[model samples]
Target: MDDSVRALRAQYGGTLPGPVEALPAPHRRDLAAVLDQARSRQQRELQESTDASLAALPKPLRALIRKALGL
Candidate 1:
């Protein structure tokens, strides 16, 4: 993450990025909405991967999971 930040700063000719809080209300809201959508998509992908892994397990292991989950 630090390397990515450094790369971003270098890409922008060493200028520091402004804080998100410094933006106007509308801009901040837009940024928040985009971030929320991105987070939701990422969470969905992670959940799907977990579900796929669980489905691939043997029945007894899967039953233990369902019992633990109260499903």
Candidate 2:
């Protein structure tokens, strides 16, 4: 396996379920790019959801909650 595959497997606790090395170089790069974009989108969605939830709270409670959560 290549270093990228090995790194991902290690990061995922050896539970990566496919032959990552079998992919052609171009396909691998495309897949990596797509996965990166998906990760970014998911993070943004999570942050937006958190912001919306926090905005629904009263200002004083929100400030206290934000302080307690270190946000």
Candidate 3:
């Protein structure tokens, strides 16, 4: 399978819509790149929020929270 197909399927929980899967490879690759970037940005924002929310706690408790949540 094309890497673009693989990336897109992974994003969609292991399935791609038929129309998307039928797109030319170049278009699929472009779509995958755009999605990957958007996912990355969202992840970064979430991480920042998680860190900020935990910042007020004492060090040991923060460590415990991070470990408990696998953050």
Backbone N/Cα/C clashes per model: 0, 0, 0
For residue 29, model 2's alpha carbon misses the true position, in angstroms, by 0.4
lDDT tens string, model 3, 1-71? 88999989998787899999999999999999999899999999999999998998888899899989997
- Which ten-residue region of model 1 has the weakest summed lDDT? 1-10
TM-score of each: 0.60, 0.72, 0.75
Residue 68 lDDT (model 3) = 94
- Greater-TM-score candidate between 1 and 2: 2
Higher-lDDT candidate of 2 and 3: 3
Give residue 8's lDDT in candidate 3 (0 to 100): 93
What is candidate 3's local distance difference test score? 0.93
Best TM-score among the predictions, by candidate number: 3
Could you give me the TM-score of model 3 versus the true structure? 0.75
lDDT of 2 by residue, 1-71 (tens): 56566545544566565666577656666666677677789999988998999999998899888888888
Ranking by lDDT: 3, 2, 1
Error of 1 at 40 (Å): 1.1
What is the model-wide C-alpha lDDT for candidate 1? Answer: 0.66
Write the residue-wise lDDT of candidate 1 on 1-71 in tens digits: 33444434444456545774356656655655675677779999988987898899997899899778765
Off by over 4 Å in 1: 1-18, 66-71
